[model samples]
Target: MPARKIKLSTSSKVFYVICYTVVALMAIICLIPFILLISGSFTSEQFIRFHGYSLLPGEFSTEAYKIIFKTPQRIIRAYGVSIMITVIGTFLGLLLTSMTAYVISRKDFKYRNWFSFFFYFTTLFNGGMVSTYIFYIQYLNLKDSYLALILPMMFNVFYLLIMRTFVSSIPHALIEAAKIDGAGEWRIFFTIILPLLKSGLATIGLFLALGYWNDWYNAMLYLNTETKYPLQYMLYAIQQQTQALASIASQAGIQVQNLPSSSLKLAMAVVATGPIVIVYPFVQKYFVAGITIGSVKG
Candidate 1:
C-alpha cells in the first residue's frame, strides 16, 4: 500500500505562518532603502533639504537626473570601462581557475597533491598590500594601466579551492573508463569531465563578474588618469568634488560649473546600481541552483 501523507498540526501551521510573516517583514526591511533611494533620486534638493528623504516624498523633481544627464560623455565612458573589465575578467578568471583546479583534482596523478599544495600555499601567505603595490606599481610598472585592475585578482585562492573540490567530487570511475578507451588526459577532461562542472562555473563566474563591477579600490590606487577611471571611481570623484576637492579648486581660482550635487549623487548611484539589479534576477536562478549543487558531493 502507498504511504499516507502526514498533515500539519494546528501548532505547526501557526509556526509556518509566523515564519512566512517574519521573512516577508525582513524582505520589506531590505527593500525599503532601495525604494527610498529611488524616491530621493527623483526629488529636488530644495525638497530634500526642507523635508529630508522619506518613504514617500512630499514633492518630486528630476533635478538629480538633469545634473547626471548633463555629463553624458563621462558617464558613458565610465560604463564602458566597467563593462570591459567585468566581461573580460569573468571569462579569463573562470577559465584559468577551472584549468588549475582540473590539474590538481586527479587522484592517481603523481603530482596532484603537490600541485594542490602549491595553490593552497598562496592562501596561507601573500605579499603584504604595500609590497604588492610596490611590485605592481614600481617594479612591474602597471600603475594607471587597465592591467592594474585585472591582473592583481585574476586567480583567487578561495575560488581555486572551491573549483578543485567540485572537480574532485566528479566520479573517478569516469576518468578510468575514459582512459581504458584510449583517451588522453586532455580528451578525458574536455570530453568526459568539464561538462559536469557547469554549476561551479556559473557560481564562480557570477562572483567574479560582481567583483569586477563593484570594485573601486583598484581604480582608486592605480588609476589616477581620468580617462581610464571606472564607473565607481568616476562617481566617486563627482561625489567628492562637492566638498573637499571643490574647496581646493576654488582656492586655486578654478571656476567650476556646479550642478545640483545632492541630486546628482542619487542619479549616479542609480546608474551604477541599475545594471546589476537587472542582471540579478536572470542570474539568480543559476546562482541558487549552482551554489546548492556545487556545495554537495556528486
Candidate 2:
C-alpha cells in the first residue's frame, strides 16, 4: 500500500502558531515566580529590601544558605522523616490498591460490585476534619507518632478507582485461560495480571508518593514533637517564626536589622523542595507514558 500524503491548510497552520504562542506565554507567567524565588534566595539582605522579588538579584550573596546549612541537623531530620513516609506509604498503598482493584475487576465475583461501591462511597462522603482528628487522637491514640502522619492517608479512594478502571480493561480471556491452566486467583493476579498493569501502577504509585512527600496537614493536626515534623511542616514553622521575629524587631521603631529573612525563606523553599524537584522527572516520565497508553483502549 502507498503511504498517504498529508497536508495542512493555511488556517490550520495559523491555529498551531496561535496555540504555541499562548502556551509559551502562559509557561513564562508560571515560571517567572519560581525563577524569582530561586534568584532571590541568593540576593543580599540589603538588596532584597530595596529591590524586592526579582529574577536578577541586585546584589548576590550566599549568607542565607550559610545560616541554613550551618543548622544541618534539623534539615537532615526533616528529610529523613519525609523520605521514610514517602517510601513506605507509596509501596504499601500501591500494593493494597492493586490487589483491591484486581479483586473488584472480576465480573464473576458476585459481590465485586458491592465491594467497589463500598469503596466509591468513601469519596462522595468523608468524616469531617474535626471528627476525623478526634478519632485519630482520642479513639485511635495516634498523636505525636509517625503513624499519625502515615495511617490516615495510606490508601486513597480516588487511586483505588483509577486502578480498578485500569484493571477492568484487562482481557477477561486472560483470566479464563489462567483458570484453564489450573492457576489459582492469587497466582493469576501475581504472575499474569500484575505484569500487564505496570503503566497504571506506575502512574498511581507516583501520585501516592507525591501525596505523602507533600503532606503536612496530618502532622499539623496530630504531631506535637519537633523531632517528628515532616519537611513541609518544619518549613512552615520556620517561616512563621522568622516572620514573627522580623515583625517584633521592627516594633522597636528602628530600621529592622536581621539576617536574610526573605532570602532565607526562599532558600528554605528550595531546600524543602530539593527531593521532589530531583525525583519528579523519572517518575513523571513513567506517569505520562502510562496515562497515554492506558487511555488508548481503556
Candidate 3:
C-alpha cells in the first residue's frame, strides 16, 4: 500500500517560515563582519577616518597590502615557518595521540585505566605558565628553536580522550580476527585500526594544524631570530610597530607615508586567516562525522 502524504497546518507552516527567516538572518549577520574586513582592507585611511568603514571600500587602495609585501622575503619566510611548523606538528601529534589512544582503547590492556587517568589528569590541572616556560627554556633548552613550538602542542589530552572513545566503539572481533591471522599489534593497528579511525584523525589533524598556524605566543617567548618568527608573530610585531608609529605621528602632527595602519591590520588579519579558512571546507565532512561519532559512548 502507498502511504498518504500529510500536509502541514497553517500554524505549522507559519512557524517553519519564521524559523527559516530567522536562520537566514543569522547567517547574514555572521557573514557581515568578514565582508567588511575584506572590503576595509582595500580602503584608504583618509576615507576610513572621514566616512568610517563600509561594505564597499570607501576609496579603493592597495596600500595596506603593499606595506605587508614591501619586504617580500620576510613575508615569504614567515609563511614558510608557519607551514613547516603546522605540518610537522600535525603529523607528530596525530601519530603519537592515535598510538596512545589505541593502547588505552584495548580491553585486555591491563593498565589501560591507570594510563588513561594519568593522561586525563593533566587536562584537569597543569603546572602554571611560568613553570612551563621555565622548564622549556631552562631545562629543555628549547629557546630560539622550532622544537619549542612543535613539542608543547604535539599531544593534547582532550584529543587523546576523543580518539580513545572513538576507538573503543570499534568491534573487538576485528582485533581478535587479526590476532587469529597471526597479525601483531603494530601490524593490526596500521593495517586495520588506523583505516577505521579516518574521521577522528582528520578532526584531530585539523585542530592540530589550526593550533600551530595560530600560535604566536611560543614564538614570541622562545624565538630570538627574525628568520625563525612564524607568520602570526611576525604579523603581530608588525601591527604593534604600526600602532607605535601611528601614536608618534598623531602626537607630532606629522603624516606618515603609506602607513595605512588600520587597513593594514585588517589586511594582515585576512592574510593570517585565509589559509586555515580554506582548510575547513576540505575537512568539514570528516569533522562532522567525528563529532557525530564522539557524541555518544559505546
Top model number, lDDT: 3
Alpha-carbon local distance difference test for all models: 0.79, 0.83, 0.84
Clashing pairs in model 2, backbone N/Cα/C closer than 3 A: none
Worst 10 residues of 1 by lDDT: 244-253
> Candidate 3: global Cα-lDDT?
0.84
For candidate 2, what is the TM-score? 0.85
lDDT of 1 by residue, 248-277 (tens): 235434444444455557667888899889
Root-mean-square deviation (CA) per prediction: 4.5, 4.8, 4.2
lDDT of 1 at 56: 69
Once fitted onto the true fold, the runs of candidate 1 whose alpha carbons sit more than 4 angstroms away are 1-18, 177-184, 243-258, 289-298
Quick one: how many clashes does candidate 1 have?
0
- lDDT of model 1 at residue 141? 94
Relative to the true structure, candidate 3 reaches a TM of 0.85
All candidates' TM-scores? 0.83, 0.85, 0.85
Error of 1 at 252 (Å): 22
Which scores greater on TM-score, model 1 or model 3? 3
